[model samples]
Target: MLSRCSMLPSSSDVQSLQGLSGIRHLAESRRFKAWFLDQFGVLHDGKQPYPGAISTLEKLASNGAKMVIISNSSRRASTTMEKMKHLGFDPSLFVGTITSGELTYQYLKRRDDAWFAALGTSCIHMTWSDRGAISLEGLGLKVVENVVEAEFILAHGTEALGQASGSVRPMKLEDLEQILEQCAAKRIPMVVANPDFVTVEARALRIMPGTLASQYEKLGGEVKWMGKPGKIIYEAAMKMADADASDSIAVGDSLHHDIKGANAVGIQSAFITCGIHASELGLDSFAEVADISRVVALASKYSSCPSYVLPAFTW
Candidate 1:
């Protein structure tokens, strides 16, 4: 694997996790020239930037860090950047933004890959109704009303589907059983743009598009994942930053998404404990530290590991 710790024997389990209180030490070290950051949990909670997130980005920028946002969000990169700006983060802090939606759109437009080449144009587009708007406007794909007419399925979010059906709360997997079964029976292929089961929205866990993708897989339907945990997005991010895997560090809150993605791509990674796994790690408060063994066990559960552990993305 390409990393600073390449001397260590290649193994599934990480040798050790270096603990840190904030990003200041990494900033001072000037180790990684390229930074790949997650959006929802690490930078902001969808409404506002994290306590020290803005300043941390500013500090990294000042230190000549080439930062790129590597988010699993279904919205396009430009849309995600606009949201970051609305959340009080300076848009100039990032060199580029790579999101699942942008990748999905590009694939559909180019029809370059084998999976994308065989697909028909008619699709069932699943996206948010209340927020996080996405569009298939330029892809030449038709959005059909029923599964019978759909040549493929585009899953971006499920929370908004619930909202559209008169429910405002997060949805359970069983809620989509009828629809998924129909698609499965027809052998329809689904493209999941965001591969996160859940995400932090104002400190509350809400169902994401990945959960629906998992359910579809269980029903024997084909699924194409577009975001993190998939190697292509990371490779695209590195290419955009003009960085090599050995010189990049990914900072994110989701283990299965960010950490595992970095691990697959041979890049160093830091895990922020304040995001999705905070409760699982028994963190009573944000300041509550997670025991090393517990952290190791939890990472193992996700079949992933982190190179460094931090309480948050603080300065």
Candidate 2:
């Protein structure tokens, strides 16, 4: 049975979370020795780093905080690192990065586990044209153009791909539905490289791999989710951080991903309300303080309350 903590907050209960403060204030109060930070909403708006994110990460690093980025981005760790550098984040500030793409690559590379070993060599890749088949390259897996020829499906979300291709329009849901139908009819198991349903990009939301995976599952197809809100990615991050879950804290904007994943791994969580859910909760920006009552109510509604709540990630 699913725990109440895993339940999502209702739209009507969408409100500000209480205990909003700066990152430094919460760190001092919670005494977390390690940090697992989210990328899209917490550190950047998908295009650039949030105002104080770089400085704050630098300060935390200087203070000897062990940090690892736990992101649901479909990009591999090396690719994510390069993107971070381009967006002005120093690689030295964090110990390591654990992305869904990297995890998927590792799984395919190892192929030791039963599920992975059972996955046939031919796959239908639903990835960005620019990203190409880099993640699956060197794995000896054949990329097929059609679902009928595929033994499995590899999804990397459509919105990001469209953006990477420089298209102003978003991929339509109907197109995705058709693809899901074809895969489901063929009984193809899908591997969702990024398990985020939607992510915010400069105040606009885009569908992610998790959305497609969920839809496929609902349509009677199997899905292998590769990132947060799941335990596998958190375990990988924990190993990279070299810290126990008890002493670690996960900081992210999405309660569904960060908070739920941390709870599953016995780590405390700090929700950054200003990131993804800010506007829906009626907040101006990451800089604004949220109403305490509304925040508490929101937590109660989701049942996945964070140990701490911050207006934004700052020191």
**Candidate achieving the largest lDDT:** 1
**Best by the TM-score measure:** 1
Assess every candidate by TM-score.
Answer: 0.90, 0.87
User: Residue 310 of model 2: what lDDT?
Assistant: 73
**Clash totals for all models, in order?**
0, 3
TM-score attained by model 2: 0.87
- Tens-digit lDDT track of model 1 for 236-266: 9899999998889999989899988888899
Q: Which regions of candidate 1 deviate over 4 angstroms?
A: 2-21, 160-175
What TM-score quantifies how close candidate 1 is to the native fold?
0.90
lDDT tens readout by residue for model 2, 198-281:
898987777777888888999999998899989998888888888888778888989778887877777778788787778766
Evaluate all candidate structures by whole-model CA lDDT and list the values in order: 0.81, 0.77
